[model samples]
Target chain A: MAYEKPLPQPTAIDAPYWEYLRQHELRLPRCQECGHIFFPPNKVYCPSCLSDRLEWVKLSGRGKVWSWVVFHQRYFSSFANDIPYVVAFIELEEGPRLMSTLVDCDQGEIRCDMPVEVVYDDITPEFTIPKFRPIR
Target chain B: MAQMTLYDFKDKVCFVGVGDTNYGALYRTKDPRRNQYTLGVEAFKAALDDAGLNKDEIDGLILVRIPSYQLFADMVGLRYLRAANTFRGEGRMSALAVQYAAMLICSGLCSTVAVVYGNDGRSVGATYGGEGEGSSPYDVLYGMTSPGAAVAHMWRRYMHEYGAREEHLAAVATSNRRHAGLNPKAVFRDPLTLETYLTSRYIAAPLRLYDYCLINDGAVALILTGAERARDLRKPPVYLTATATCTDLTFFYTVDDFFRDGVRRCAEAVFGASGLTHKDIQVCQIYDNFTPTVIFGLEGASFCKYGEGFQFVQNGRISLGGELPVNTSGGHTSESYMQGFGLHAENIRQLRGEAGDRQVPNCQVAMYICPAPICAAHIMTRR
Candidate 1:
């Protein structure tokens, strides 16, 4: 049976992140005062300096796979068909890491620190999900 | 490294007693006769009986994964408590509850404290994945929907970065199972072999069935009093040398660095206050919610280099007869998964020389580590 995985419910702290993912651009919040760039797209004060001034800076959409796991068991009914799919932790060029799935490649090809580029998956009508594909 | 102000204040308290019902096998599934409160009270009662004290003696109550503090207090016949609180979490809160009780004692707010923990996640069929409660939505949407999946990635990363293989993880599982066999109360005492571990089906590719923690119904209570008072108690006092909690909540699942900094922070404070190095620890009861977590914790506690944790476990270093034993009570994996409560209880037994077959002989200082999402640690030394 085919089913959709859970979707993100955009909160005020993270709405801009989903909005940019929908537009095929990856952006992260950077502290204007301390120059600290971070991920998960929801932040108020800088984690380093506690400054409230921040900006959503567009990323290069390139990163290295810090780590990855292949889901062999279906924790979610929606992901049953995708059993053995890979969830790769991507360390973007700008320092922050994001939890994303590997795409446009075979499962055996996933490796740590492998260079990857962001790819858009329009999994839902309202938004697009940003995943990574091994940079060929 | 900055220190939390409370770290200096923990030395006065000690864990004097640990008690639990026969979580042997009957309690793994829910029984109509018991709920969370009843189980909690049962453990609480056992602890009081073990401590040779009455319910009226406890002035502080810290409940982890239990509800109805008032009802429980009334049920346990504990009246006029100076402090009562309910804590909830994966496993971190169990050890954190110890600190909660200790801080209350340190501040002169309470004379004696009881840290009670009870869980029914298995029979209740609690999921570690999906939406709110314990999981992050980012993971719920992706296929990495469970704690096991998240930790599986951690092992994959650790292996890739440090030259570890499934064989190394097999060592961890094999050692714990061996230790569990000695523990009659352990939930799963069936012997596990490395060959079997390597062949076991994967729940999340890198994490085999052996790497996961069992979800079973159980409760563990720890009673704390002043170190001076504990020395004269029914059992040998396990002095609370130090404890610390750390969290890296900024980015995604398990946070920015797979929660390594939390473990590091906890280790610094725990070791610093004890005036003990990693070498002084005779036994280590890591919160083995998953096998890779032990790997992360070993690195955090300075037992080994960041990427060399796998190498350290090889050749029986983590086994009972080795230089340092890790999880001699089987931890959450093979032991009763009372959240992280069982790990602390096991270390206390080891320190008191009461751990029958699994005892690490000449055990003096034992370390309890809760490594992950939020890390907490305690150093308990025999007095």
Candidate 2:
């Protein structure tokens, strides 16, 4: 079936982030001057030092749940089937945090700071998104 | 570098008129004819009547929720505008509008300013989530849709950081409902209890149905003028003592600091300029778009130490007769969710000692705070 769920429309600033994800590699921009790693990959310059000299560094695909929530109400038709699904803010070991889904885990067992590792969800041939699973 | 301090505009401007559509009357009214501007006009006319001023006297206009100043100005025949602008229909703009209006008046741009807001949200089916509600395409990918979801995560982290239990969140909803019971205009006044709150379905887990605000149709308007001119108006003037705002432009529209740094800055500016501490505030109206927001607002405003807002609200602390009453008008959750517009109006009413049964006695000083990405706060006094 065609992908019915929402996909990130890559822009010029962050297109490489998605392109790398398509290859099952989790990389984010690290500022050369300030060494600040940031997520959503939308910035051309370092948010901390405003340095334009930054490079996409490979990540460990590991993080902890800084915070999380379960969706009991459906706001999007594409997400209706995933009612009660878990979405979380994963704070990567590299220090940047981003929102992604938590899969293959019991909702009742989820707790803040629980160790998690990234897993790829290739919903369509054109796109592959990173989700997380508890590091059991 | 020059040291920057807030230009003190305290007591220079005052709210002369406050008006709104009958919230209780329009709770579920689906009047297709009653659009945003029509509702705005209704509130505008009532504010003019309340101020005992003719619409022709409104030389300045600041609009919220409404799309354009030109559209509203054309409809209301306000052609003498020296200053006029419109804000995006975000709840945070309510206090900003008042602050901006005060600036205009103090700058001698216009003496009498009208800040108007109207929303046909309920009538138009405001989901407050999904594609068009201003979520990025990236956020949609993870099914992170509503504003409540972001707050839920924050609330959960608050729980982890502060050891606050579910009862703390329940207390906020129940107490607001308790206050709503005393408010004739409140929408959900039928005695909410801890049990009821606990059993409420989670719209976003960790933030239950009761945590979410009601989506309803309504409009709110307030008129402002020089404090000297306001004293001669139809009602007692509520002076704008001090106002401050801070912003966080994070990718998620939230911060791990839980908005404390920003809110604390706003608190210092508002209190420092007003010469009033939280103790001097007889009543408060913190923006409660979500119940957790109330917790964040209180902590950020220094009503309690950071991580203790959930505790500060316990044991009737935030009740109408509590040490520091908050959201005595039932706030956005039980009251009509006019975004921050209704809460701002409620604060003015409390300061005026005109809030009917929900009035805080001798409410000489009142404050309003919203601890969102754009954290804002203002202190008002009847004197």
Candidate 3:
């Protein structure tokens, strides 16, 4: 039997992000005029300055763990077996934070402000999930 | 409009009736809608009965349903009435409901109004288990299956920003459970130790089973009438001193900043209207879907300084005998989690001196601060 992985359905606003993930990069929408970076990508105008000229920019995955929790209960059945996993919000060096799971460390060992690096988990043939690991 | 003062609640509208059903884990065997309908009807009737008013007297109705299922007009038969107005949404909807009801009465649009809420997670089947059929496309795609996960994100961020630990989180659960022990209405009304909280199975990372509120089958209702009418019917009518409502663009991914500062605007507006500070409030009925939310609301409501809420709980400041006793009726943690309606009912009970064992002694002023994804707040006082 072959393992089937879940794939996130992409929309116009977030399509570029998924495309960027295919090439192993994290991309966000940056306003060409105001130089503001936005996540979960949106339409043309910059949310800050309402500028229509926005460019996609890759982010530095280096950041500190802002906060985290270890899940002992599986909210989704697909994730049941992966009990006690750590879910964290990492504040990136590029001034934006993203929510992703933390890997490569024991759940109990995870702490706030711990330096971390992004590690991609190739869960499926077409998708590689962006996760974090402690930088020691 | 000069940001209408919060003091508009003075000698305006009052809550004459309040009621709630039992709170406990609702298993899959029960129908959630039935629980909501039955409890809602009962509470509605009880409020009407308590106010010495007939159902026909109600000209406006406000309903708050979780999982965004029930509409105010549909759930309680408000549409069938020849009533003047209706409104619907989550518990925070009450703030606007009360304000609208006040305006209706003040303007001779309508007189009596009823606000109701109900839910049954144990019997009706868990609506939060999987991708909801009609959720936002963003929520469905990103595995935002339940509030537990979304709030966990905020909790993780706060923990990382501050040097707060699991122990600090443990303190919140332990204190609420201890307070729940004294209230007969609470579902998990037994003393809980910090060790028990730390070891409890995690519902979401950073949130233990104890840190999350129980999804039980229950209903709560309140009757709002002009202050003049309320003064005549009930013993010690609980006046709505102030109310405010506010909303933020809803997208967890785009709106990464989850400090709940959006809700603070509602709190400040309401508190400003009431001319009261945190100290003037003898008891506070804050919505507690998760322990961290309560902590966030405490700071947002000016009960404590920002980012210092964890320290306040650490010092036993939010307990039963603390400087400002909060959620004396066990709150969502120990009592029933009826969206945010439970907090509203508890505030009425406290202000009227009807709170039995968990009463805050000689309570005069009470505040019900609701910080749902869409926020609403109200301050109540004894008449």
Say which candidate scores most in lDDT: 2
B280-320 in candidate 3: lDDT tens per residue? 88888777787887888787777777778889887677887
Lowest summed lDDT window (length 10), candidate 2 chain B: B1-10
Share of reference contacts kept by candidate 3: 0.52
Model 2 pairs in collision: none
The segments of candidate 1 whose C-alpha lies over 4 angstroms from its true place after superposition are A1-3, B1-11, B27-30, B131-134, B253-261
How big is the RMSD of model 1? 2.8
Worst 10 residues of 1 chain B by lDDT: B249-258
**Best-to-worst TM-score order:** 2, 1, 3
Q: Candidate 2: DockQ?
A: 0.87
lDDT of 3 by residue, A11-126 (tens): 87778777787788977899999898865575678888998899999888788887665556655565566665565767787877766767788877877788998887666676
Better of 2 and 3 by lDDT: 2
Candidate 3: regions farther than 4 A off: A1-3, A42-44, A106-109, A134-136, B1-4, B24-33, B66-91, B94-96, B127-145, B246-250, B253-260, B314-316
lDDT of 2 by residue, B34-112 (tens): 8889999999999999899999889999999899889999999988789999998888888889889988999899999
Tens digits of per-residue lDDT, candidate 1, A55-135, equal 999999999998888777767777777777788888999988878888888887778899999999987768888889988
True contacts kept of each: 0.84, 0.92, 0.52
**What is candidate 1's lDDT per residue for B1-383, written digit by digit as tens?**
66656446656888887898666664445577676787888888889888888788899998888877887788888778999988875577877788878888887899889999887776677767654445666666676667787677777877876688877888888888888898888888889987789889988888888899887778889999988777778887888888888876544544434566789898998887778888889999888888888878888878887888888888889999998899998877888788888888888889889899888887889998887777888888885
Rank all candidate structures by their DockQ, best first, as comma-separated numbers: 2, 1, 3
Give interface RMSD, per candidate.
1.7, 0.9, 3.4
